[model samples]
Target: MSADIQKLGEVDRMIHEPARLMVVALLSAVKEADFQYLHRSTGLSKGNLSVHLSKLEEAGYVAIKKTFRGKYPLTICRLTERGREVLENYRKVIRAAL
Candidate 1:
């Protein structure tokens, strides 16, 4: 196998998954987004979104914050510094391959 193939194998699986990729990609572009916004943007069910968020959180790729907007609760998500670097590196690998 070529070195490029091995590099592909080294890709971060956490963000490699399509759904989680979407979540991270969205977070990359924004300062932060709330649960409802992600739900609407990704069109993922609440449970599915929560699951992906949990995985990203576990990987230290994203920060999840719980707060209250008046009488309602809000769950906000944002990319961490590590996450930004990871995403940028991922892009670099892809671009190099191309």
Candidate 2:
């Protein structure tokens, strides 16, 4: 009901976007996930996945590590403590809102 709460709600909404949320959810479930893994799990193309990944990385909610597996480069994503907290808060807010 307060302005601060409303602003927090807006931020929650932004990170809770369908694609971004799925990415976060998947990462939260696993220790680390590769780009192909996320692509398969979310059924999102590389470009779309990259876009959403960039957003999450930009927010510092996720950490992406780049490495090489044989001849190919791998992008492994992990959820940060900040991300977990935000997701938990988001869950609480959603339950309260509903």
Candidate 3:
């Protein structure tokens, strides 16, 4: 295989998936985001978003916090430093491959 094609293999599969990619990209643009905001922004159902968030959390790529906004519960998410590095690398790999 060509060098460019080989670079594709270095892509991070965790962030490469569409839903997680969207969540990561969104988090990259903000300090953090609430569950409802992410839900509306990504158009992902609550369950699906939860699942993806869990995976990201497990991989240490995202940080999730649960707190209360007055009386309402809030789930806030942000990408970690490692997540930022991985995402930047993923972008470079994809760009080189294409």
Top-TM-score candidate index: 3
Q: By TM-score, how accurate is candidate 1?
A: 0.93
List CA RMSD, all candidates.
Answer: 1.2, 2.8, 0.9
- Among these predictions, the greatest lDDT belongs to 3
Question: Candidate 1 lDDT (Cα, whole model)?
Answer: 0.92
Looking at candidate 2, the ten consecutive residues that score lowest on lDDT are 2-11
Collision count for each candidate, in order: 0, 0, 0
Residue-wise C-alpha lDDT for candidate 2, range 18-86, written one tens digit per residue: 999999988889999999999999999899999999989989899999999999999999999999999
Q: Candidate 3 at 1: error in angstroms?
A: 3.6
In the predicted model 1, the residue pairs found to clash are: none
lDDT of 2 at 48: 96
TM-score of every prediction relative to native: 0.93, 0.85, 0.95
What lDDT is reached at residue 88 by model 1? 93
Tens digits of per-residue lDDT, candidate 3, 46-95, equal 99999999999999999999999899999999899999999999988888
For each candidate in the order shown, give its overall lDDT on alpha carbons: 0.92, 0.87, 0.95
Cα lDDT tens digits for candidate 1, 1-98 = 66765688778888989999999999999999999999999999999999999999999999999999999999999999999999998877776665
Q: Count steric clashes of candidate 2.
A: 0
